[model samples]
Target: MCGVLPIRKFILLFTIAFMFHVSLAQEGEVASLSQNNLQTYIVYVHKPEGLHSMQSESLHRWYQSLLPVTTASTEHQQQRLLYSYRHVVTGFAARLTGEEVKAMEKKEEVLSMGLHPEKGFWKKSNFDKGVIIGVMDTGVLPDHPSFRDEGMSPPPDRWKGRCDFKQTANRTFVCNKKIIGARSFQVYDNLLHSFSAQPVDEIGHGTHTASTAAGNFVRGANLYNNANGTASGVAPHAHFAIYQVCSLDECSSTDVLAGFDAAVEDGVDVISISMTSLNVGQLFEDSIALAAFSAMQRGIFVVCSAGNSGPSSNSAYNAAPWILTVGASTIDRNIIATARLGNGDEFDGESIFPPNSTKRLNSKLFPLVQPGINGQMLSQNCNNGSLKDINVKGKAVFCERGMEVSRLDQGKVVKAAGGAAMLLVNQEQKGFTTYTDPHVLPASHLSSAAGLNIR
Candidate 1:
């Protein structure tokens, strides 16, 4: 699951939302955009079984033949064709105006196509041996201990994917047997100019997900001395591939489709996607749903995040029956952190930022202040620049959780304002669920009830 591109100008953030009727075996119609505005559109074509094994150059020419001839130069027309997909689906992604899309839809071979629009463990056994799991996220950290290939066999002979993390001036990445392939689809987006073209993970989400999927065993893994123990993915013996479809904060639908196209062609047994649109869309119109349908046709297991708006009614995403839609679930353990108020009221919470023995904050009770006592809207969340008026030096700042503000960022705001500690309380919707986040300052995430008492 990921963002969807609009029919016109490509925005930084694209999300899929719409309803349409179309199936791969039948002809489908599409709404047209203004010809003046040109953008990338996924074009699905009916590929013959013989074409499935065609050479790359032969396939490219077949895709190019579908486009209408124009007065533009050959090189200019070539640039318009972005990708020629053969496995995930018989299609191509190209820069086209509404007029061009209208023309392509008329082709008898074209199937339904639209704007480009997710895990888990098991018994440690041969259940995952010779299996290949494809991860479509930001990317992976090849050097992370979890991905090291010690004690692992080489990838199966059927594997066709290859790593694309070419050595650059300042960065280098290598793929081992455990992580057999790592390719980036973001280069086609051209929006990420600051980052390198390699498939290295800058955002930690991809690293975490990859490590949780089929990462190799790493002994004595822990965060800040918490949860100390060996860590390993459920499918420790499974070969995996990384498809970087997301950037720092955004994911384009076209890029994500390209990832699907590659993963399917690469012979992955399972494809894991942990991103989704804000709302649900039609099966054929949504990019992920469509690509997943093609992947399902190829016998690939598709697992997708049900979206983050969980614990809410109708919050499910990836509703297509062919895909396995998963959501968050509670674990058996917790990393407890205690917050003691001046009045001797103690609240037990959670935090992954373990206590540093050198800086014992429990020795004495520090002054605690709630910045929102005066009813300042932003102060309640400890947003940046919201605590400037509050004198919280040498004190612990109590903050309420708010939308669009990360818990660690709230701690940064409190710490920047000279506060000694942070007590992050959850919103009503969050209830008693507290995340064990690593905070910049000594912090504890409390529940809604705890927040009310603190208030």
Candidate 2:
């Protein structure tokens, strides 16, 4: 009976062992077999802490050796290791939310006021809804009160975006906090790099030019006080989108072109360019002009200041046919007065005045004088020269027209000599006004006779 029991137990153990071996063999065959003969799997490897640099290679070689000889040859080699922890895992299908869309749209309004207010023609149509005007200049002061409204509702969705001033690997597009639809396209060192603490107006020219186009009309009296300090722009209600195109030292044509392209792609409605270059052919072939033309074809208006070299035969980039050239005209078309002081009195000489039909001051007109003399006082003939010990404070200084120096340059001299204002008379010819406001402190031009009288 005992022998029979032992035999029964042996048969049972054999049967179980044989079934288990068969199952293992079937599993191994299935593992070796691949569907479509092209199956692949993605593997993410985590390295051991404090492992040597070569440990990964050594570990891979050891792992490869452990595979069955046949399976090893058939297995495809595909391995990826992540060395940096900065990147976040994300799928390509991710999209911006509704709130983000509104944020992006608001950037347009903010940019419009900063760059091109005249282009915001919608204001004329009573459309409170603003358009985007991109200013590819320096960064803007986002905290300026002109862009903020105390009681207005929040901006709509679609105007939100990111700002990447660092120009890191892929960071770009900064959204304005106060101005809805306002965004800045600063490309690190490439273009629009912010160096100082605030996007300040280092060169007063940019601030002046920008203020003339779309300065914020904060107070009700701003419109009436256009003749006063920091007057209102042509379009006060419009918004601004500032793009820092030029830096403190230099400006690059390539950066300007890139900024233009980005502005168009972002759907900016207008682009105001205050800068000018002498290279016409280069500007024409430039991708910036082409992009601007594309925007123009889409009904976008482009306005630019005529080079200060106007009132002469010399033409500048703004003079180009495709651009709207703006020439500087004295307010009310009045004759710009240039006065000179000597011996504590005012006089004018040889400076040619504007046309007789031109506007004049309502105050009493002093009698005209000759090239070297005034009515009562004998004038010192300093042909575009300076006077010594002259009480020029709160008074005008008269300088001759010729000296081969710019009127502004002469104005600086007068200003440095403690002169309050300057009057530059034409020396070479008549019927022309030199753009002198940009040069010296509060300056005006006078005819040769008016200049002599003031001198």
Best by lDDT: 1
Predicted candidate 2 versus true structure: per-residue lDDT over 360-395, tens digit per residue: 432334332232344312122222444444445555
Residue 348 alpha-carbon offset, candidate 2, angstroms: 10
Where does the lowest 10-residue lDDT sum fall in candidate 2? 9-18
* Stretches of candidate 1 exceeding 4 Å from the true structure: 1-124, 190-197, 277-280, 342-344, 357-359, 372-381, 385-390, 402-405, 427-430
Model 2: lDDT of residue 372: 38
Residue-wise lDDT of candidate 1 within 1-455, one digit each (tens)? Answer: 87755622112211112111122321112213324466667787887667767888898888888887661557856878878886687788777776777777888888866553201124323537788989888888788888888888888888999888777787677888888999988774454365556888886878887777777778998889888898877677788799988888777777888899999999999898878754335666677888999999999989887665656787777788988876656767898889988788899998877667415887777888888766697998899799998899999888999886888899899989999888999999899989988888889999999989988
Off by over 4 Å in 2: 1-124, 141-200, 218-230, 282-284, 297-300, 311-330, 333-398, 402-424, 428-445, 452-455
* Candidate 1 pairs with clashing backbones: 3-117, 4-14, 4-117, 118-273, 118-274, 118-304
